[model samples]
Target: MKILITGGTGLIGRRLTLLLQKKGHQVVYLSRKKENIKDVIVYKWDISAGYIEPEALENIDYIVHLAGAGIADKRWTEERKQEIIDSRIQPIVLLKKYLQEKNNSIKGFISASGISCYGTDTGEARLDEHSLFGDDFLAYCCKLWEEETRNFTPARRTASIRTGVVLSREGGALPKMMLPVKWGVGSSFGDGRQWMSWIHIDDICQLYLQCIEDENITGPFNAVAPAPIRNAAFVATAAKVLKRPFWAPAVPAFVLKLLLGEMSAVLLGGNYIINKRMAEELSFNYQYPELETALQDLLK
Candidate 1:
């Protein structure tokens, strides 16, 4: 299969590309940078200017739309928020327009959606793909992103992997979570009862591979681990795995609000997201099913 991946230089995209290649699939990246990498072909695209190299789309059998501004990268000012929305929405619009113009119909369109679309949970309960849409900034952003993806209807099949906090040793939330624990100054945000629906990075990539190949697996599927842990438990597990002490008190919610503004929602609140559809229908056996085991393997 010939796959064209947007934002292929990102942590998830970079790893996903290699995994696809190992399976004997041809992978090309649409990047902002045009640097020559060994076997990987890099094509350039200017999102703001609405331009992408036409060759990138030629002979592309599958497209994994991973391109987007990091939600938690900066404070969510009005400008930053628009950037987040545009970064996700514009890419979809651009891709659809280009594919239509070329009369290209791919096998499927796989995109990266966030579990935050379920919104911050007020109570600890298992949430699924059918859960109510989150009304927060992250949720709103995800909705718009996914909505744009729907534009490819009647022409191409699509699958949106509603991903959770992807745990990775290279990058993602795991490294930041490990840092405080390593210093023995680890703590949780707020009361620490907020649910964290997480998945091992390997599992996330595997899930994407499944979405790419399986035509029946369509719509929004929660890409998360089976066990959902509390923020406090998450902190303790990281501490235990790192062989460090957890002595610090929980960070006050008010302090976090003052520090992060609207972005505090990502840390201060979380959903009890479950991979019900993915597990039962797709039968995805997670590489790291439990939090402690995932931590031990990554931290060790």
Candidate 2:
């Protein structure tokens, strides 16, 4: 199979590309810059101008859309929020237009969504794919992201993965969480009872692969592990795995709010999301279902 990936240089995209290549599938990248990328044939795409290199779509069997700006990369000013949505929606609009115009045999389209679709805070309620979407800015962003995928015509199969907090040593939240712990000043945010749905880096990559390979799998699927941990337990476990002292008081909510503004909701609030479709419908096996096992693999 020949696959084309957007945001192919990102954390998840980079690992997924290697996995597909190791399995003997041809991988190509649709990047903003065609230069400086080695070992892969990169095709340039400019989302702002609604342009995609015509040859990039040639002979491509599958496409994984992971091309979105980092949601937490900046303060959620009105302008930054618009960029977050545009970064995700514009790519789909461009690709959908091209897919409609081009005569290609693209079998599947898999795109990235976030668990934040459920909301910043669900307290202890367990959420599945069919649950009501949250009424916050984050949920609004994910809703728009997933809605655009429905119009990807001509693709036989389309799946939108609502991914959880990916625990990776190389990037994402794990390293930042590990940083303060390594300094013995690690602490949970808020009161520390917020439920965090998390997945190991490898498990998430395999989930994406499953969506790509399994024609029976379509629609929205949660990419979280079966077990969800509280924020306090998550930090304590990380400290234990790193052999560091966990003795700091929880960070006060007011301080976080003052520091991060609207972005503070992500750290101070969380939801309990379930991988019901992945576990029951697909019978997927996770490499790291438990937080301790996941941390051990990444930290120790």
Candidate 3:
């Protein structure tokens, strides 16, 4: 299989590329800069200019669309919000047009969607694929992001992975959480009871590979661990793994609001997301099914 990936330099993309390559799949990465890597092809394209070198589309069998502006990069000002939307929507529009023009023989189009579409803050409800869309900015962004990919239509089999907080040792939430915990300042956010749905990075990559091979898996599937833990529990688990005390009082919501602005809702929010479909249909074997175990392995 010849797979082309956008945002291939990102945490998940970088790891996914290596795994796919190890499995003997030909991977091509779309980038803004040119760099050489073994057993992989890199193509340069300026997505904002609406130009994707024609040759880049040649013999491409699968497309994993992970290009987007980081939601938490800066305060969610109106301008910053638009940047988040454009970074995701523009690439999809370009890819759709490119596929239509080339009449490409692509088998599948796998897009990266977020569980945030379920809502900014979750209640006691365990969000599944059928949950109502949230009215928040993150929800709106994800809705439009997924909708843009739908334009691929009848020609290509499409699957959208509504991913949760991916737990990895290299970067992301784990490291930030670990830093404070290492200093024994680890604490939970808000009331410390909000549910957090997460998955191991390895599980996420495996699911993406499964989507490539499984023809029946289509539409939005939650890519999260089966177990959903409270924010407080997650903090305690991290503390335990680092052998630090988890006795700090929870951070007040007002402090988070002042610090993160609109983005604070992400910290205050909780969702019990379940991978019901993935388990029933795909039978994914998780490498890190428990939170404590995941934290221990990642920290070590």
Candidate 4:
């Protein structure tokens, strides 16, 4: 299978590309910078103006859209919020338009979505496909992101993966969290009881592969581990793995609010998202099922 990926240079995209290649599938990357690489094609595009070189879509069997501004990149000023929203929406719109104009025979369209759509704070109720959208900025961003994908008229199949907090050693939330914990300053956020749904980076890549091969899977499937852990549990597990102290009291919510501003909602808020559909449909096995085990592997 031939796959084209946007944001192919990103954390998830970079890893996913390597996985697909190792499995003997062809991978093409869409990026602004041109670089020399083996066994992969590079197509350049300007995302802001919505222009992708016409040749980029040729003979592409699948599309994995992962381009977006990092939500936690900066304080969520109104302007930064708009950039986060546009960075996701515009790329999909451009690709949709390109697909429509070219009338390509693309087999599957897999785009990135997030569990944040369910809400910032979901308490103990495990969120699934039927969960209600959270009335928050992150929720609004994810809602629009999924809606854009729905507008595409691809020739074969379409899927939007509502991913969880990915556990990767290279980047994302894990490293930042580990830094403080390794220094013995780590503690839980807010009440330390909010649920956090997460997945191993390896499993996340495999879920995309499952989407490519399984025609039965579609719509918004939660790409998370089967077992969701509370924030306090996650902190305890991390402390155990680091051989650090977990006795620090939970960080006050007001302190987080003062530090993260509107973005603090992400730290203070969380969801107990379930990968019910992914498991039932694909029978996918997770490489890391428990928080402790996943943390151990990552910490190593």
Model 3 error, position 280 (Å) = 1.1
Alpha-carbon RMSD of each model? 1.2, 1.0, 1.2, 1.3
Which 10 successive residues of model 2 have the least lDDT summed? 32-41
Candidate 2 pairs with clashing backbones = none
Q: Over the full model, what C-alpha lDDT does candidate 1 score relative to the true structure?
A: 0.87
lDDT of each residue in 227-261, candidate 3, tens digit only: 99999999998988888999989999999999999
Cα TM-score of candidate 2: 0.98
For residues 49-113, could you state the per-residue lDDT of candidate 1 as single tens digits? Answer: 88999888988888899988898899989999999889888888888888888777888888888
Write one digit per residue (lDDT tens) for candidate 2, span 1-300. Answer: 899999999999999988998888888999998666556789999988889998899988899999999988999899999999999999988888888877555899999999999898889898999899999998999999888886678688789999999989889988988889999988999999999999999999999998888888899999999999999999999998888999999999999999999999999989899998998899998889889998899987
Q: How many backbone clashes does candidate 3 have?
A: 0
Candidate 3 runs further than 4 Å off: none
lDDT of each: 0.87, 0.90, 0.88, 0.87
1 against 2, candidate with superior lDDT: 2
For candidate 3, what's the RMSD?
1.2
Which candidate number has the best TM-score? 2
Counting only residues 3 or more apart in sequence or on different chains, how many pairs clash (N, Cα, C under 3 Å) in candidate 4? 1
Off by over 4 Å in 4: none
Q: What are the models' TM-scores?
A: 0.97, 0.98, 0.97, 0.96
Clashes of each: 0, 0, 0, 1
